[model samples]
Target: MIIESNDERGSVNRSALRRLTGIDAASFAERHWGTTPKFTRSAELSGSFEDLMTVDAVDELISERGVRTPFVRMAKDGRLLEKNKFTGSGGFGAEITDQVDSAAVLSAFAAGNTLVLQGLHRLWPPLIAFTGELVRELGHPVQVNSYVTPAASQGFSPHYDVHDVFVVQIAGSKRWTIHSPVHRHPLNNQPWSDRRAAVERHADDSPELDIVLEPGDVLYLPRGWIHSAQALGETTVHLTIGVASFNDYDIAHHTLGALQEVEGLRAPLPAGWDPTDSEAVLPHVRRVLGDMRRALDELDRDPEALQRITERIASRYDELVRPEPVRPLRSVAQMGALRGQDSIRLRDGVIARVVRTPESAAVVLRDKTVSMPPQCADALELLLGGSPCRLDSLPGLDTDDAVVVGRRLVREGIAVMAGE
Candidate 1:
């Protein structure tokens, strides 16, 4: 969407993405939107005087309806810190349970204590919309994972988020260390359990910016900003909007999705064949396995799927945050041939470069990411990421231009079915 880069003020508006090292939200986001970790401070990436998510209609819609779910061991504290692991029990005596964490951790927060929040969007819709709006305003797809902490008997220990974060100090004053990126682009998309270890490895580089943020103030940390916080007074509430990027590791995961679809690939091995009988293996069997490997090579032909997969991932991280923001897409439509589609917009999800397809009405998510039927592509192209295509007549999907646009959507995840 034509993000403005290399500006003098060291900040940016939603229209043009500005890039400042400490203020590099738009530039860095465009580059590693789904891969590398990036962070920006007020001076670095000074956002304009725009009031994001200010509409009463939307603000009310995405407000916290109290913690709709239960707090797990990891979220026992207001901030998700030491107990962030999703696997083994920690020395802190925290354990993971299957109980659903609420949209907002009210019970734990009501007492004004530190706590860990797990998946706020699952129980809330407004938060999801807020996150989605932020992504759209930023002109990028991002997921929204939120964090709200109350000042209590204890404070959160030093830690980092598992994704690139845009912190909106919504309700109270919260302090942050605003550390440097541990790894130039640490994957916050990595499991919560693994984040601390990554941070520990880079703890030596955890330089601090030391800033206190109040409501309406925004703080950004490229995925690995080593920071810690405490309530300014009794409690502090903030929204941490994260964008989980997809890197090579993510590309590696798409293969698993493709394998699930390929029939010959899914077929079971010959009867009685077992790895336990390794001593009885045959050369032909080995060659057959090589053939399967070749199948993957064929699957990787599309250059777009990887980008699509990464963007989808990035958007999910965007749609999970605080109050939903409204994109002026309606204005964009007026400028071009924008027509509304009654498609399912991912609730609390982010997608990028969605376009319409030619033949089927299918919507594809990351056509470059994986294979899909044709009909579903069009809806996806329009619905996912900005298709980067010429906006054409939107009088249904029967015309020639419609077909071309529809095909693009099938490739992206903008629609429900294939493009025709």
Candidate 2:
């Protein structure tokens, strides 16, 4: 299915979500999210998998890149191979534990072991781009892992993931069996192993869905859904993109932290508090609870405070972002060479938004915030539009002021030189 653009602002472009699920984002969220499993079959999606990763690319990462453990793991007959079995000293006198032993990995693969590539989004360029887009669309952190299994072999036992996963069949085919969750809406700390007997029984019983996923098929399983997969006739390669959704616990934790600014909330509890005597602690507890209630009420009424919390949670995911390597001398030279006709664009994965208060305006990106004078508001707005704009074309700033703003953006890694 083709992704269709939407005109609504701040609404998730349903195109990508539709491409994966064959349904609009809103419908999917309303109907299936954390409730059931979904399988979408499309011929167009099969070819798009090649744009994310290929068999040749996988081989290159394993053999030529010297990838080390825990990045690459091998599993056979439901058991994970130890890191020492597939890793060893690096070549050219590098550290003893720095490289993966490609020979050992290939030998294991030939013996019917499934090779699992972890965190491909961090190591593979294609996945980095694709998963980054997924993160922005879903407003959550996304991780990608690839599983290459031999024909007629299974990699792991029946289990459930703590995070929701989109299973993209990239090559060949695999048979997937999905069962009802042993625990509904399980948190990250909950694992299938914690309910091993229940999971085993569920796997043996009737499942909600059982089907062969061919190339171009996408299967989505919410957290805590029991499932397992085995390769079909040909060797199978599939990508599993995990989405870690933020929940109420995260908001509550941040809210508590924000409430720490209240001096009453920061005061220590009674030194001789008696745990068994409710009367002894009643006064102090009542006061503390009252203070917390009032603080939270105030925070809910303050838009700026709520926005700060939202930005904080959003920026926390930026830790997973790997920025482009900046060359000091070259970047400085590029900044100095900027001309009035030169066009610049925001770097990929660099998010910039202008935050305005009555007194001042600030451009916030990732971990950096640059407060600017009120006069630069129009120029900042133009730059934050995220398109290529010539320096001289800024709406309000003159050539000199524009140069200053442009230099600051470039130096702060928010924008890059697009073209002359």
Off by over 4 Å in 1: 1-26, 30-67, 70-111, 115-130, 137-148, 152-155, 178-190, 194-217, 224-226, 232-234, 259-267, 270-289, 297-420
Candidate 1 C-alpha lDDT tens digits along 56-75? 42223223222222332334
Measured against the true structure, the TM-scores of the candidates, in listed sequence, are 0.49, 0.83
Candidate 2: residue 111 lDDT (0-100): 90
- lDDT against true structure, model 1: 0.46
lDDT of 1 at 307: 58
Candidate 2 on 344-398: residue-level lDDT in tens? 7777666678888877679887767888777778778877777787888887788
| C-alpha lDDT of residue 418 in model 1 | 15
